[model samples]
Target chain A: AQTVTQSQPEMSVQEAETVTLSCTYDTSESDYYLFWYKQPPSRQMILVIRQEAYKQQNATENRFSVNFQKAAKSFSLKISDSQLGDAAMYFCAYPSITQGGSEKLVFGKGTKLTVNP
Target chain B: GAGVSQSPSNKVTEKGKDVELRCDPISGHTALYWYRQSLGQGLEFLIYFQGNSAPDKSGLPSDRFSAERTGGSVSTLTIQRTQQEDSAVYLCASSLGVLGEETQYFGPGTRLLVL
Candidate 1:
């Protein structure tokens, strides 16, 4: 079984500033996928960014980027130019690729990020 | 035209009563999933469905919690003899395929409360 850990239970970032949410995982599989999702007060789970384990280059989407250290089993999400809309519960998920087309996502406890003005 | 959708934005039922939650996945999507989120439990995967294959109900907490996908399009999760512990936000998601490697699109979720 795969386990994802988000050490920071809560984080606060000044609007327009940068913030980093920490995440670590335990897995023996060489190939897998990592993702960051945001759940706002609206309770909508929004996909933020993703990183493929086999790829050395980290993944970035607009203002969001990941620092993926495969050996360390660390995949941290960095949010730059943060906005008020970014205030929400952020979760780190791990989904492994298997033989078939089926995949199940495992999520961490999540960190509540607050964008302070 | 796109994105997963769930019904009964909110539901309240008495303890011991049965309740049903619905999910409508994106058209042509071959994968659908069910998850529950509560204050005590962050996010838990309950089941996964693909095409006409049998669903992976391994995540279901108990026999009272069961889900079925009809025609591989829509799905319904029924809770028999609901309990207060079952109160939580039930979320539905879908993806292009059933592969665990694919990105999943989530619905807003249905908040269920057992009184």
Candidate 2:
């Protein structure tokens, strides 16, 4: 099976500063994709960034980026120029194919991000 | 374009009663998924549907939990004899269901509170 792990339960960053949340995953598939999702107090989950395992370049989206280390099985998200609105629960996920041939996302426990003014 | 939508933004129910959560996926998307998020268990997949057919229901926690998608667009998740542990935010997502187009767009989840 596949599993995602976020070692840090919480992280804080000053506004305009940068913060990085750690994520590690285990999967036997050689080709896959990684995603970061943000869930705020409103309970709406928004896609933050995505990284393709086949690509050597790290994925970035405006202020959000990822440091994906394929060898170490690590995919960490970096939030630069952090703003108060960036405060949310961030989850790292990857797709896994079930025995019945359907794909499902396996998610990490999540890291709560707090942006301090 | 409208994103994935879920009905009943919040629900409160008794322990033994049943509850139904609804989801409307993005238009033309062939794959829909159900997931649950709770304090105890971060996030878990519940089921996956492709074009109104469920190829995988393995993520369902128990027999009491069941889901179905119809018209290949809307889906409903039903919990029979709801329990306290079933209290969580139920999320729905949809994608094109084709390889290399697997980015799933999520909806604002339905928060289900079981008393």
Candidate 3:
């Protein structure tokens, strides 16, 4: 069983500043996928970004980038130029490629990010 | 209609009552999934449906939770004789099923509150 662990329960970042949410996972398979999902007060799980295990290059989307260290089994999300809208519950997730190929995202206990304005 | 949408946004029922939550996937999306979120439970994988194939019930918490995807577009998740522990936000998501590109688009979840 693969499990994602987010050590930070809550993070505080000033608006226009930067913040990084930490996440780690345990997986025996080397060819899986990892993801970061953001759930705001509206309760919608939005896909922040994703990284494939086989890829060595990190994935970045606009102001969001991931620090994926496959050897260390670490996947952390970094948000630059944070805004007030960035306040939300950020979750780290793992997705298995096998088992019928379902996108069953195993999420970690979220980190409540507070963007101080 | 533009994205995944779930109905009965807020459902409140008694402990022994049954409740049904519906999910309308994106048009033509071949994969649909159900997950539950609670304080300590985090994200609980309930089930997954791909096309018209047999559904995966391995992630279901117990026998009381069942789901069905009709015509591969819409799905209904039912919890019978619900318990207090079953109270959580139920989330549904769908993807294009492009194999390696498994980008899942989620819906605004249905918050289920069992008294």
lDDT tens per residue, model 1, A1-117: 678999999999999999999999999999888889999977778889988899999999999999999999999999999999899999999884332434678889999999998
| TM-scores, all models, native as reference | 0.95, 0.96, 0.94
lDDT of 1 by residue, B1-115 (tens): 9678888999999999999999999898988989899983467888888899888777889999999998889999999999999999999999987444577989999999999
- Given the true complex, what DockQ would model 3 score? 0.59
Chain A only: TM-score per candidate: 0.93, 0.97, 0.93
Which candidate model has the greater lDDT, 2 or 3? 3
lDDT of each structure? 0.89, 0.89, 0.90
CAPRI tier for the interface of model 2 = medium
Q: What is candidate 3's lDDT per residue for B40-111, written digit by digit as tens?
A: 446888899999999988788889999999898999999999999998999999998853476889999999
Q: Report DockQ per prediction, comma-separated.
A: 0.52, 0.63, 0.59
Q: Model 3: which docking level applies?
A: medium
Clashes of 2: 0
lDDT of 3: 0.90
Report the C-alpha lDDT of model 2 over A1-117, residue by residue, as the tens digit.
778999999999999999999999998888888989898988877889988899999998999999999999999999999999999999998887766677788889999999999
Candidate 2 residue-wise lDDT, B11-94, digit = tens = 999999999999999999998889999874567888888885644888889999999887777999999999999999999988
Off by over 4 Å in 2: none
Which candidate would rank higher by TM-score, 1 or 3? 1
**Native contacts present in each candidate (fraction):** 0.50, 0.57, 0.57
- Share of the reference A-B contacts seen in candidate 3: 0.57
Candidate 1 DockQ category? medium
